[model samples]
Target: MSIYSPLPPEMIWEGWEDFKPVWQEIKVNGRILQVEMQGFNQARVVRLLSTDPADYLNSAYQPGCILSFSPQQSTTPGAINDNPPV
Candidate 1:
């Protein structure tokens, strides 16, 4: 895939190698969301793992939107226990 940003690649991909995003799956309004952890209790929406078209229409789950969530320990391997803040 080609990125057509006016900025130079160096500027656009600065720290790309060191940029390791913490990805987590979260459930919100009965929809599963893949998010990148931005900081404590904060995560940025990456994508919605849902088959419903209505889920894509919800502004709250849009990519780049920041969401607040409470962290929880997961007992099952590869399972997400954190829930978005009410």
Candidate 2:
């Protein structure tokens, strides 16, 4: 039996069940994503790395909003600055 066949309704996103991350470069077409690298509030804190303040100008983004990033670097956990940027 297929997973989608047995699933009840309301478990899909506009008919698609699974999601693939939308990967995007930090800067494209004069646009950048304001991402939240840490914390719940004031999230999108990762924007510190982006020099452009207009990246998120008049944009609505909340904490826990997923962001797509690349370079796929891994950082060690623990005390702030303990590891290189991820």
**lDDT by candidate, in order shown:** 0.86, 0.42
Q: What's the true lDDT of residue 9 in model 1?
A: 94
Worst lDDT 10-window in candidate 2: 40-49
| Local error of candidate 2 at residue 32 (angstroms) | 7.3
Candidate 2: residue 14 lDDT (0-100): 58
Query: Clashing residue pairs in candidate 2, if any?
Result: 36-44
Instruction: For each candidate, give its TM-score against the true structure.
Output: 0.62, 0.20
The C-alpha RMSD in Å for every predicted model, in order, reads 6.8, 12.7
lDDT tens digits, residues 1-86, model 2? 33565656565335474554343224324555445344332224233234556544533433345544344333545434565455
